[model samples]
Target: MESLKNLKVGVIGLAKSGLAAANFARSSGASVFVTESKQRAECAVFLKRLAKGVTAEFGAHSDRILESDIIVRSPGVPNNLRVLVQAKRSGIPVYSEIEFASRYISPREIIAITGTNGKTTTTSLVSDIFKTAGRKTVTAGNIGSPLADCVKKITPRTSVVLEVSSYQLEDVERFRPTISAILNITPDHIEHHKTMRGYIDAKARVFENQKKTDFCVLNYDDKKVRALKSLCGAKVIFFSAQRRLASGVFYSNGSIVVKLPFAGYSIALKLKIPGRHNIENALAAAAIAAAAGIKRGAIEKAINGFRGVEHRIEFTAAINGVEYINDSKATNVDSTLVALKAFEKPVWLILGGRDKGAPYRPLGSQIKKKVKAILLIGEAAAKIRKEFSGTAELLDAGDIDGALSLASRRAVKGDIVLLSPACASFDQFDNYEHRGRYFKNAVLKMKKRFEKK
Candidate 1:
C-alpha cells in the first residue's frame, strides 16, 4: 500500500470535517493547507490554534487551495463552488473525508445507516443491540468519532456501526457496508444537496458498493425507501410499525412481533422508547442485528433496556404543572411532525432555527390542530411566523432564552412546552445537542426560580 507520504492535500472549508481532514492528512505524512470563506475574528482565532506546520488562508483564497494534489471537500462546501470548479479544471482529484480516509484503514465489516430521520436513533440502537449480543461493536461516523478515526482501531472481530450522513455517502467509492440500512427518505438537507432527489441519491449510495451477500434493511412504511428495492443488490429485510411482514419485524396489538425465516415464531417484545417512530427504529435495529447473526433473545433484551438517545423527545422537568420536553434533534419538518404526533396535550412549541429549505405548510396544519402557541426564534423565525399566522398564535422571541421564558409563562397545567425546533441549530447554538442542553438548563432555572417564589 502506497502511503499518502509527503502528499500536498488542500482542505476547503474550516468546519469539523475540514479540521478532521487536516488532522488525517498530517498523520499520513502529508502537508495540509485549509481554506475558509470567513475571515472573521472567531475564524482567525481558530486558525491560529491549528498545528504550526499546517497553513490556513481565509476569505476566498481559491488560488492557494487549487495548487494542492488532492482537495478534501468539506460537506458544507457545495460542489458548484468556484473553488471546486477550478480544482476540477486543474485535474486535481477532489474527495470527501470518508473517501480519502478509506484508503488507509482496512475494515472487513461495516454497517452504514442513512435516512432523512431516525439515522442516529437506529444507529445507536443497532450498535447497542450488537453490544448486548456480546459483540465487539463500535458506533462512529457522522454521530461522534469520524469514520477515519474509528477505522484505525478496526480488528477482525470488530463490527463498525456507522451513522452516515448524505454528505458522507455522496462521494463514497469502494466504501461498502456489509449491512446497510436506509431507514426512511424524506426531503431533508435541501440547503446542502440543493434538491430532494439529490439528497435521496446521496443517501442511496450507502448500498451502492454493497455485494449480494450483504444485507440492506429498509423501511417498508416509507414509500421512497420501498422504491429502492430494485436498486439494492443486498438481501432485503423490511421493517414496519404500520404493516405486517412475513419475514421481518412489525407491531401487533401493542407488542413488537418478529417472524424470521429461520424461526417462524412471533415474539411479543416490549420497547422502552416512546413513539411510533422509535418502534420503526427498533424494527430497523432488530433487522440489522438479526442480519449480523445476533440472537432474537439478545435483541429483545437490548430493546427492553435501551433508554433512547438524548435530545429526541427528552423530558426536561415539570415546572408549575407544565411539562418541558427538549426535542432539539428534530431539525427537519418531518422529524418535528413525528414529535408533534407523540404529544396528546396542547403543545407550546418552540420552533425556528437555520432553515433547511423545507416548506412549513404541512407543519402549519399540524400546529393549527395540535399546538396552542408557538415561540419562534433564530433565522427562520419570520418565515415560520408567516406560515403559521392564521393557524396558530406565533410569537417571535429572537433567542432561545426568550423562547423558553415565553413558553414557560404561556404553558398551562397539562400543557407541554416542547422545544422541537423544525430547523437546523446552527443559527442559535453549536448543534442540536447544545441547543437541547441550553433548553434543559433554562427549564431547570425556571423550575428553581418558580419554587423560590
Candidate 2:
C-alpha cells in the first residue's frame, strides 16, 4: 500500500464520503483540507465530524483547494466542477474516494459491482456469501458508507465488497478490483453523464484496469452489459436471469444453476427478495462468489438466507388490508418498471422526484395495466403527469407525506401502495434511504390510525 505520509490532500464535498476521506487521510499523516459548496451552517454536522488537524472552507471552493498535491472528490460532486477541471489541467491528480481508498488497501481481494440498479442488493449478497465461506468481509462504496471508512480494517485476508456507482468509477485510474461485476446497464443518471453512451462508459471503467488473472462477472440478460465483454481484460463470467448459459451462472427451470470451472450446482429460487431483477442480482452474486473460489454450499446458503437490503421494494406494513411497499431506491425508470412487475395486485404507485433526464413515457403501459392511480410528487410531477395523464388516474399529491395521506384514503382492500418514485430523492429528502424511512414510518403511523378507527 502507498504511504500517505505528509501528503497534501484536498477533499471536495462535505457529505458522508468526503468526511470519511478527510478523517482517513488525517489519520494517515496527510495534511487534509476540505471544501464544501454548502454554507458553514448547512454543513455544521459534517464539519463537527472532521478530524482534529483537518482544515475546511465552506460556502465555496476557493483557490485554496488548488494548492493541494492531490484531490479526493466525493461521488455527489460533478467531475466538471471548475476547480476539478483546473486541477486536471495543472497535472495534480483528481481521484474518486473509492480510488483514493483502494490505494491504502493491499493484498485484499476487492469485489466491485456497478450498474444503474440492483448494485446494493447484489453487493450485500456477495458480502454475505464471502462471510458464509469464512472469509473476512467488509461492505462499503456506494452502499451508504465510503470504502475509506473500512480500509483500515481490510487485511490481506479481507474480501472487500463494493457497490461502486458510475460516479465513483468516473475518476479511477488504476483502481482495479480482484473480482468486478456489472449487474445491468440501464438509462439512468443521464443528467450527470449527459448521454447514454457517457453513462455506459463510466460503468465500463470498473473492469478497465483488471488484468487477465482477475474475474469479470456480467449480466448476460442485459444486452448493453453483455456487449461490454470485449473491453474487459479480466476472465469474463456471464450470469443470466432469462436463459441457461453454457458457462457461468444462469437460471434454468426453477433453479439458479452455476456452471463455472471451480463449482457447479443449482439452487432453487427461494430468495426472500421478489422480482426477476433480484434473480439476476442473485445470479450475479453467485457468479462473483464462484469466481472468488467460494464453495457451492456457502453461495447457496447465503443466497437463501439473505433477507435483502432496505428500501428496494421493502414491505412496510399492511393497513386496512392495503399493503404498503417502499421502493424509494427505485430512483430510475427501469427500476420502477421492475417494482411494478414484481407485484400482481392493483397498485397505487407513488411516482416522481428530482428528474434525471429520462422520460416517464416508457412507464405508461405498466401504469395503464397495473397501477390503480399514479400519485405524483416532487419536481418531476408535472412531467410524469403529462406522460400518463390519460393512461391512468393521476393524483398530484406534491410530496411523500401528501401521497401517503391520499393513498391511505383512496387505496382499497387487497391493493398495494408502492413508493416507487422513478427519480432521485434529492428534491424531497437527503437521499433514497431517508425517503424510504419516512415512507415506512408514515405507513406504520397510518396503521395505528386505522386500528383506532
Candidate 3:
C-alpha cells in the first residue's frame, strides 16, 4: 500500500532479492535501477529481465546507487559499504527487501521466524500447519523465495511464513510480523555483525515493531532468547523442549504437549523428525501456530507429516558398511555441535569452509570423544587443524572431493563420515546446497567405485 509513482529506488546487488525488489518497485510505478558489483557479462542473463522503466548498472561505475531515494540491499551485502554510507549521509535510507515487502502486506498476517539455526525447519512447519488449517500460505525470506518476490501474491486470505535471518533484520525499519518467533539465539554471523551484542541487537529487531496486540514466540530453553521477553511489545509465548511450560508448548516424558493460557488440559502431538534440536523446532513451530489461532489438530497433523529440510544431517549413502551423512547446512560451531550429538559412532568428520569468526576450540571436546579422525578443507582448514589437532587425528584434504575420498577410505564398518563443516560454503561451492549435493555425489561415486572392485 506504499505509494510509488515518482520515486526512484536503487536495488543493491544483482542477486535474487535485488531482481525481485526491482521488479516489484517497477510494477508499483517506481523508476528502478539495479547496481551489482559483478561485471556485466557475469549478470547477462539476469539483466535480460529488465523492462523499460528499470535500468541496470554492473561493475565499477556503481556509485550510482546513491542517486536514488532509497536503497534496497540484498541479504549478504554488507551495510557498511562506501556507497551505502554515502547514501545514508545524503539522507537516503537503506532497507532490507523484507522491510520493503512488509509495506505491501495490507490485510494478511505474516508469521516471521528468526534464530541462529532451525529457522528453515520451523518456518516450513508453520507454513504447513497454516496450509493444513485451510489457509493460503506462502513461504519466503531465507527459505523459499525472497520476501519481495512473494509480495504480490498476498491477499486477505494469504499468510506469509518468512524464515528471517539476522542479515535481513539488520536494516528493517517497519518489517513487523503479526506473529513473530525467535526459535533460539546462538553464536552466529559474528563475521558480519562484528560482535555478540551487535548480532543480538539485529536478531531482536524482528519483534521491534510489534504492538501489544501482536504475538511473539520465544525459546524458553535459550537464556538469550528468553531474555528478549521484555524487549518485545507483543504477547510473548515460550516454547521449551526441556521443561513444562504452564502457558506454552513443551515436551514431556514421551510426547510433545501444549498448554494454552486458558486451557484446562494440554495436547500432545506426534513428530516425524528425530534429533533433540528438531523436537525443539517442532515445539517452536507449534507455539507460533497456536498463537496464530491455528487448530491444535491441524498443528498435530502438520508435525506428524513434516519431514526435515535437506542438507542438515541428511543421509547420503551407505558405502561398504560405512554411512556418509551430509550436514552441509551446519555453517556455525553450535550447529555442528548439534550434528555431532545425532550419531553414536566412530566419526570421520569433515569440517571447514568460510570461517564465520566462530572459534573451533569450543568444539574440541565433542571431536575428541566422538570423532575418530577429522578431515579439513576449504579456507578454514588451517584454523580448524590448529584448534583440533590435539583433540583428534587431523588430515588436511585441501578440498571437498579430496576430503570425501580420504574419509571414505579411512571409514570402516559402522563408521560415520559426516560433512558438518562449521563454516560458510562460499569458500568452495556456490552455496550450502551445492556443497551438500557435491558431498552426496562424491559419496555415491565412491560407492560405485567400490562396487566394481
**Best-matching candidate per TM-score:** 2
Stronger candidate by TM-score (1 vs 2): 2
> lDDT (0-100) at residue 239 of candidate 3?
85
How does model 2 fare in lDDT?
A: 0.91
lDDT (Cα, tens digit) per residue for candidate 2, span 1-453:
688989999999999999999999999999999999999998887878889999999888998999998899998698778999999999999999999999989746999999889999999999899889999888999996799999888899888899999999998999999999998888999889999999999999999999999999988888999999989999999998778888989998879898987788888878888888888888999889888988888998999999988999999999988999999999999999999999999999999899999998888888888999998999999998888878999989998889999998888999999999999999979999999999999889888888998
Task: Give the runs in model 1 whose Cα sits over 4 Å from its true position.
Answer: 44-52, 262-265
Ranking by lDDT, best first?
A: 2, 3, 1
Tens-place lDDT per residue, model 3, 51-100, is: 56788877753677788988898888886888888888898988899998
User: By the TM-score metric, which is better: model 2 or model 3?
Assistant: 2
Ten residues in sequence with the least summed lDDT for candidate 2: 260-269
lDDT, model 3 = 0.86
In model 1, pairs of residues that clash are none
How should the candidates be ordered by TM-score, best one leading? 2, 3, 1
Q: Lowest summed-lDDT stretch of 10 residues in model 1?
A: 260-269
- Candidate 1 lDDT over 145-177, as tens digits, reads 776566557777888898888988776777778
